[model samples]
Target chain A: SAVISQKPSRDICQRGTSLTIQCQVDSQVTMMFWYRQQPGQSLTLIATANQGSEATYESGFVIDKFPISRPNLTFSTLTVSNMSPEDSSIYLCSVDTPPAGVYNEQFFGPGTRLTVL
Target chain B: GIQVEQSPPDLILQEGANSTLRCNFSDSVNNLQWFHQNPWGQLINLFYIPSGTKQNGRLSATTVATERYSLLYISSSQTTDSGVYFCAPTPKAAGNKLTFGGGTRVLVKP
Candidate 1:
């Protein structure tokens, strides 16, 4: 299992501001993902961050609104640009564990709870 | 894109009771995992059963790849188990992206 941690466990931000969340993993991984869990909603994949490459975002998300940076194998950052009340949600970072035999699990970070007002 | 669904959107169980959570997918997947989200919104990986069954302490999970469904069992439930449970599956054709289910909210009473 991989240990992942996110900064700013909880934060309150004013509308129109941006928040950059940092994700750090204990071990090097090939794939790191960003996710958003909105109020009363399921977790949605925001993007897939690969080292030395541009992150592949999902259908409803874009690089402009949610820009991502993957500087290395063990670290990445997700910046939620132009925050709004609707953008308030818990952001999480996860790493795809190296395949151990037949099992490869994705471990999640503690998550950053952002409240925009 | 594969669609995932979890049954019994909300469940109320007393301490020491046992319960089952189900996750059904629209297509065959190469990876399936169960996760528990505590009240504080921390996601804890429970199992990574793509196919077959596996158990760990009070929780067990079974995933039938052919059937495109999985089941999670929690026994001797405690108040600490009160939280939301989610299942995510990655389709064979979908690279590393995982599609998550809506999740089942469990409330354990003392």
Candidate 2:
């Protein structure tokens, strides 16, 4: 298992503004992902951050609206672009199968709580 | 897309009670994970059993891969166990992407 951390535990933003959330893992992992959890809702996969390439976004999500960058194995950033009140949600980062993983359970960061007004 | 159904949308339990939560998925998956999201919203991994049974402390989980369903058992529940429990399955065809269930919200009473 690896220790993970996220920046600015939470934030309050105006509609049409953007927020960039950073995810840092303690060790190198084979997979890194971003998830969105709207208020009173379950988690939804936003994208998969590739180590050296552009992210793979899920349906209903686009690169322009939620651009992701993974420059290496242990760090990735997801920016919610041109945000709106609908973008208010908790953004989470998760890692799976660290280099030395055995059980292969995915672990999550504390998450960044965003409020759009 | 995989359809996941979780039963008993909400749960209320007395201290030291037992409970069972079920998650039914629509397709074959390479992995199924159980997570507990605390009041602070930090998700704690409970199990990674794609099949078979595994136990930790008073919590245990069983996944019947062939049937595309799983069960989570919590015995002698405590107040700290109050939180949202989610089951996320990674489809074999979709690789590592996790599709989550609607979740079972549990509240443990003293």
Candidate 3:
């Protein structure tokens, strides 16, 4: 429903470093989100980036660890702070495209694969 | 926060065969989605069927919201269809928060 793109399709970083994953949508969306997929696990919501405001992080996820930025309706960034091997996973950005007169549905990006050593 | 469950954690199929993937939710959901994550880890949205039925190409999905379950049907499966299938559901008021199931891994052999 929406064309989404993420930068740095992949990265290999040393522990203690941080990486910022960027997500850009072709058009404006009502909502944007960041999700993390750990090894052998399902996708987990990291946070919801609110345009021009602070993000709302999910349980067990802290803003200090996974900071999010939604500068505008079409762009957002998620930074994995103080990286560790446990932080290695696929980070995905998604946007919602609501049906006309109906509820919204989410579409995801290709994902940014991050491997921390 | 809702609990999502998927059946048959893994499935092996022959090319040109057909398969059905199931997703069940613990509570009512205002929005239901099915996704196919390719080997490269790109998540492809297969269906956004909050209710009723929707189809695209050889893939179709049916969501019986009243029953709290959804089914994804793949007709004439191909090698490309081999991947992780995930089901995510969110309440209408939850905004963009989605609770994803563990996912079903599918392997197709030609």
Candidate 4:
């Protein structure tokens, strides 16, 4: 299990503003991901943060709207650019545990709840 | 991309009762995990069973990988168990990327 934490636990922002959420992990991991959960909905994968390279986004998400940065193995950031009412959701960061003869699971961080008005 | 489905979208149980949650996936997966999301929206990992059976305390999980389905059993439920339960399965080629199912919301009454 990994201890992951996110900054700005909860925040309220006006439309057209951007909020950058930071994710820090206690251990070094090779794979980090960002997820979004809309109110009363299932989780959606936003992107996969690649170390020293651009993040790989999912089908519905683009880098321009949700840029990601992974400076090292234990830290990453996801910025929700140009906030809107529809962009309000909980953002989560997760890291993959090592698979050395054990079941590899992704441990999640305490998500950041963002509300845009 | 694999699709995951969970049954009994909502469940109401009295304290001390037992309940079972089911998860069915479209394809064979290398990773299957169960998570409990509390009212405060914190995700707690319950099990990481890709196959066979495993138990912890009053909770147990069984994953029939060949059948592409898994079951989670919670016995002697308590008020603290009231929350949303989610199942995530990752394909063999997808590394650690998880595809989550529509969660089952459980409400335990005192």
For all candidates, state DockQ relative to the true structure.
0.67, 0.65, 0.72, 0.64
> By summed lDDT, which 10 consecutive residues of candidate 3 chain B come out lowest?
B90-99
- Candidate 1: residue B23 Cα off by (Å): 0.6
Candidate 2 deviant stretches above 4 angstroms: A100-103
Q: What residue runs in model 3 are displaced by over 4 Å at the alpha carbon?
A: A98-102
In order, the Cα lDDT scores of the candidates are 0.92, 0.93, 0.90, 0.93
For candidate 3, the docking band is medium
- Using DockQ as the yardstick, the better of models 1 and 4 is 1
Order by DockQ, highest first: 3, 1, 2, 4
Sort candidate 2 into its docking category: medium
Tens digit of per-residue lDDT, candidate 2, span A46-78: 999988888999899999999999999999999
Q: After superposition, how far is residue A116 of candidate 4 from its true place, in Å?
A: 0.4
- What is the overall TM-score of model 2 with all chains considered together? 0.97
Clashing pairs in 3: none
Task: For candidate 3, write residues A4-76 as lDDT tens digits.
Answer: 9999899999999999989999988878889999988999988888899999888899988998999998899
Comparison by DockQ, 1 against 2, better one: 1
Tens digits of per-residue lDDT for model 4, A15-47 = 999999999999888889999999999899999
Clashing pairs in 1: none
Model 2: pairs clashing at backbone N, Cα or C within 3 Å = none
Per-residue alpha-carbon lDDT of model 3 for B16-74, expressed as tens digits?
Answer: 99999999998878788899999999888888888999999999999999889999999
| Segments of candidate 1 deviating more than 4 angstroms | A99-103
